[model samples]
Target: MVTVSLPTPVQPEFDTTIHRRKTRPVPVGTVTIGGGHPVVVQSMINEDTLDVDGSVAGIRRLHEIGCEIVRVTVPSMAHAKALADIKQKLESTYQRVPLVADVHHNGMKIALEVAKHVDKVRINPGLYVFEKPDAQREGYSDQEFADIGDKIRETLEPLVVSLRDQGKSMRIGVNHGSLSERMLFTYGDTPEGMVQSALEFIKICESLDFRNLVVSMKASRVPVMLAAYRLMVKRMDELGMDYPLHLGVTEAGDGEYGRIKSTAGIATLLADGIGDTIRVSLTEAPEKEIPVCYSILQALGLRKTMVEYVACPSCGRTLFNLEDVLHEVREATKHLTGLDIAVMGCIVNGPGEMADADYGYVGKQAGYIALYRGREEIKRVPEADGVQELINLIKADGRWVDP
Candidate 1:
């Protein structure tokens, strides 16, 4: 009998890092997504594109606070033309900011016009080549489906060629709520429908020799959103497509639940190494979304833009008020970027638990706290001075920076 060699089983202990999916680099202004670049953060301004002054200020505010790419809606030809003034004003007053124009619903002319003013253009697959809903229709015949596909190709070609010639990129954004009538009839309201929707547009762009594409599959419900993106990645892998992805949960509402909901979907895919850029869509000010996006990236160790605090939950053995000390420590060290600081409740688990931190504060006894520099006990200071002492230790080690 011939012997068969078995594949090696995975050792999870050695698999500590997230290996991002391989994607070709797609440029958006000066920033590049995928191709092993640090995951990019993006947000959209709510200002109307026609309000040139307001739009310029809005884009500048978001970009100043670490939003790499900003998108503005272009619902009409007037709004599309305004992007030229907005782009010029941004350069003259502020700095050159990467802008994307969102076009929808028979928007070919608007897209071609706005393509001249922005670094990238985003088109919805379901709406770009609008197919008026037929109330009398049962389902599309195979011939009718092919007919619509041809119409889409004819409409999309000019915009594709314009962006390709300019070396700009395009986002084939597919929303679950807006699947085309034909796509819905063909694949039903499901993740398969979403994947097929993006794939059709991608193939069209590929045929035109335009590959600077980013794809998004967004749904209001987290489960549907998650399934759509995962399915898209699987389909792209099989087809040898290396386009980057833009991750978000559409209509993620406002307040605590919104942040949690967006995080649950975006972070889950990010952990699996699926997304190259992300936007945390919230109903609050556009500025509010930037911090949430950075927080998600930081928590995953994908990008370190802020100080990392590792604090233990208080137990009966906790010496001092763990909550109060943690707050104080955080306030002092929050500006120290790329540093990991730990605050522990007591000695029982403090040193052992915080072994990986750059610096740690542990309660050693009543009215006293011990400081650590990577598992080595530095000194014990009075609890009242613990926060200041931690700051001093960080400064002594040359890691402190003024806020």
Candidate 2:
């Protein structure tokens, strides 16, 4: 199930070389992730799971905007029980999008009770097993480590059995910020420490013959996040395990900064063919995070879920109110997925620069604009009428679909 492969070949439209690491396929509800499935785009709800109505609304909104998977936090038994009602509500109305339960602190306990309700249960390896930092213990001896493994097996077997029986999957998610005190004391908060933390739990599941699993390594810092995933892959190979990876950059700020920061961290691993499911963690409305997830996947040629935009950087030679017109063009064309549209500031390089676009809008003179069908200049129109003219041009070419 774990095979190293050449990058999946792309059609001529995209120039890319990213062969995803081949792992066993894990089904989360109806969606298939990893094992050559198109990189899945998912988002986590900010709403608490116990607030069923609010969480359901968030999940519905995300699904409407092309989010393939939605996750909710389950911090207590009440939260775990509420997932059943939430699942039923969404299934009864909205499409039965795959739902995930993100359980921290005593996740095994939460996961056990919620196994029958959600598609997948995500447990942070860092917080799953907590030993007080001050507990008196030296470097674990072989006998002590063996006893610990047996204890883990005894604790995890019931949950593992329940998940396998219910046809649910598990994500052994690891976070840099919450590495266990044992891990911190032993490995000093390094990537190795993170991987070891996940492997501790993963080995238990494998021992119990459970196979539906996903893994994640997340950090706010890009370098640390990227290094952790790369090292994770190397270790998985050595152990001959093939669990799919969920990629993310935790607490990636908000607005443009979040988008850029997430893009750098997620895309770096994706370009190397290392991620299967990804969430762009922005400090904004959860629905707003969906577009960035798809955009990152689109840019990597892993998947295309929205419009392709080409906007030239404005300069001294630019004409017209570039800001107002650019916004207009976007408002008109944002729904045009797979069609490349160019909005340029001036003729100095607009026509040549937009050669890849199917259609373009370029500044000609003050209060005037030039349009293009690729590189050829098509027509001239007044600046005030340019937005409408460009829409008309695209519609005439049969490239426009009513949004």
> Model-by-model lDDT, in order?
0.94, 0.86
Off by over 4 Å in 1: 1-12
**Compared to the true structure, candidate 2 yields what TM-score?**
0.89
Error of 2 at 289 (Å): 1.8
Q: Which consecutive 10 residues in model 2 have the weakest lDDT in total?
A: 129-138
Q: Write the per-residue lDDT of candidate 2 for residues 58-94, one digit (tens) a residue.
A: 9999989888999988889899999989989888877
Error of 1 at 203 (Å): 0.8
Q: Residue 90 in candidate 1 has what lDDT?
A: 94
Per-residue CA lDDT of candidate 1, range 1-403, in tens? 9999999987678676898999999999999989999999999999988899999999999999999999999999999999999999999998999889999999999999999999999999999988899999999999999999999999999999999999999999999999999999999999999999999999999999999999999999999999999999999999999999999999999999999999999999999999999999999999999999999999999999998889899999999988988888888878779999999998898998899999999987999989999989999999998888888998898988898
TM-score, one value per model = 0.96, 0.89
